[model samples]
Target: MNENKIPEKYTYIILTFTLISIISCIILNAFLFYGFMASIIFSIYLCRKSGFSIIELFNMIKRGLYECKSLFILMALIGAMIPIWMSSGVVPTMLYYGLKYMKGTNFLFSAFILTSVVSIFMGTAFGTISSVGIALLALSKIFGIPNYILLGAIVSGAFIADKSSPISNLFNLTLETVKIAYKEAITSMLKTLLPTCFISASVYYFIGKKYSVVIENSNINNFMYAINSNFTVSPLILLLPLSIIIMLFLGIKMLKSVFLALIAGIVVSIVFQREGFNHIINAILNGYNINTNFVQLNTVLVSGGMISMISVLLIIAGAVSLSSIFQETGLIIPVIKRITSKIKSSEELILKTGLISGALTIISDQSVGIILPGKFLINKYKELKVKNCILARTMADTGTIIAPLIPWNVNSLFIFITTGISTISYAPYAVLCYVSPIITFIFAFLHKFQGRKQTKEIQVKNTIK
Candidate 1:
């Protein structure tokens, strides 16, 4: 008999209790505290039933805590760096130039592409959505674009970059958890992401047909003037962040790269902003505020700080703790086993796993969706003789891309709260999010574009020689 096994009724009880806890946490806005407590209790219960001593449970907690230390430290550093960079005029400079380039174009597609690029650079969907996304929303009102379409385009663009960004925490988390090379994971993602982005861009282009306007060369000049007048702009400032991007592409660890880039930004700020050391200290502590004559530029530039990310950090910690408990309690194992057992074919397995992972985003959050499922599904794919690349690709497509589709999910909620755009309004325009999983499933089932055969052929030739 399995010591951890509970009666079927008790399993239902646990599930029910967990659901109630989660819902209450959400309703009461106490998700962080309640989630942490619930996780601890569940972990204790599981360990006790499994015949583990309190010391063993404490050790497990300690080990789990240690495992997340690096991630926490990285988060804190990023939290600090965001405001410093903002105050230094780096983000505002990008937005200023970005808006200048967008003048008198198909604004929808332009917004989509611009946000996509920036989000990719930022490696954060929420950051992209909050910064440039808010600007685009304001632009939508000015240009008379339908609100739903604008919302869709914004979400589509942000997710396109978010899904494919090498610097994204989810991207790195998935690669590390699956033990796949980061380059291979990115390559696999590109295979799925590029096509989905093409479709989404096409959709936005056609939708914006009526709104297309020819940009006069002078209009571009005026846009540039507007940006320059509004914020203290510098091109060299981008070099610091660009170096990090180059380093990431060259396979440096993300945390180290970010840390170095952040230091470079601080140095630039000290020199360029010409603010006193105490002023820099105050900005880092309380957040940065940029007051510009241009309200739009002011809005775009006003973002990021150590204080801003505390809420997100708390939410992440709570969600991760609950996820750890769910894992240790064997709840997820039964679910994974049941799903994997039903998968009779490789195609079915891939599709099933993708859908399950997508569904899990509603409850488990994106990190858990990829990390937990990626770990379990990778071995299953290997045993099935399915290519690990395909599994990794599917995980990226479904797990990372689908988060914004679930209204209550963290990413979606963040956008909804920040942009005041409902998930329902944005659902149709977010073609990449909806289409990626479908495209991935189609390829998996139809066996299209599979390079694994070539890999296998080479392996066989080597063996025969």
Candidate 2:
């Protein structure tokens, strides 16, 4: 037996071990850290049996952590940046203006579009849902719209940004793991994203026709008063987000751009919002707490802090450690190779990738879904000469968005908690959640057809020659 080769049965054992640990943790409502640790220890034991020493395993873990150091810092910065934006009145201003736009229109379609826009800005599906999503649900009663249908639209829209937004932690994490540039990933994602959005919007537009109801001016007035009374809603506050975009377009790195935005947010909070230094500092380290008489508005305004990011960071570290052993000890390569060897074309590989990602999301959460698939399939992607951006985009399209459709997934649970809409109720209406994967598969098959046509043309030219 080759000392270097890990037995195939070990791969199955490792996977079974990982699955049990994750599922057990989920059922126990325990932090995923415990599950991750158990898998790491089991993998280390398996790696030792395959001839790797303890020192080698330690080095692997260290290298994995070192590679993720920048990601950790970026995550922390994002954590701090969000709360600062909230306390600085930037979020409130955007919320105030975004809410004002919900005047006599197709409620379902408008909910989808508006939530998509806000989710992009906020970069948090939970935040988008708690704020605008809840607001829309309340209005659904007046419009005679089914709460489930409206929620489907809202959940669909909220997750759109979670999957694609530059500021989204998951989006950033996916890109980092796949080693793809942001601009390239976004460009590739748009091929599927635009079509899905268009189709979802059209469906909601016609469906919205049946539930048109005039908004009472008083409801709008109350919303305005609640926001305006607590925070100074100004267009000037929009400059913070714009500044980040301008910097990014100017070739500034995401880290520097976020840092600059955080600084700008601090100044705006002090100058415009009259936030105290202590409050700003507290928001940066802990989280922003908005004190308001309006409970609805209060729910939206509160959230964010560097501390909130620790759980995500821990998960990343654990996943990376697990991935590192697989990479270095040759534990998983055989199984992955066997799988990829059957793939005849890039399109097929893309389709398989979507299936794997969706399956992972069903079994685990979005972070694991993205990280493991990207790590496992990256070599196959490189071998096929397909750009990693496509892989990243595919994972985001399937894994990240599919979470909300899974009833037991954390994403769905959070949505249910925030909006009181169950996954079963809203999932059918979350058209984009399903449409994205279908669009990706279609693109894959379309490319395959195009490739065959080109090959036939080449053969004909050779015959003429």
Instruction: State which candidate has the highest lDDT.
Output: 2
lDDT of 1 by residue, 1-465 (tens): 132454444444555666677667656756344655674586568546756576755655566556667656666666666666676666656655555666567888888888788778767676566546755664564455776788788888887655667677777777777787878777777777778889889988888877655333224454457567654687786676567657766767667877887777777777876656777777776676666564544544444456655665665565555555555545555566667876656878788778767756766677667766777777778887787777778878887788888654667656654555667778877877888888898788566345457668899999999
lDDT (tens digit, per residue) of candidate 2 on 1-465: 122467888877987998888678767878776887899999889878877789999898898789768667767786787778788877777667655775667768888998898788767676567546755775665455788999999988999877888778899999999998899999999999999999999999998876654453335667668889988888888888777656655667667877888898899899988999998999888887787898767765666577767765776577668766766676655654566678878898998888877866665467767877798889888987778998998899888998889765656655654455667788999999999999989988887888789889999999999
Runs of candidate 1 with Cα error greater than 4 angstroms are 1-12, 27-36, 39-55, 114-191, 207-227, 292-297, 365-385, 404-429, 447-465
Residue 6's lDDT in candidate 1: 41
Q: Who wins the TM-score comparison?
A: 1
TM-scores of the candidates are: 0.75, 0.72
Off by over 4 Å in 2: 1-4, 106-193, 203-218, 344-350, 356-433, 447-465
Residue pairs with backbone atoms closer than 3 Å in model 2 (clashes) = none
Query: Ten-residue segment with the worst summed lDDT in candidate 2?
Result: 211-220
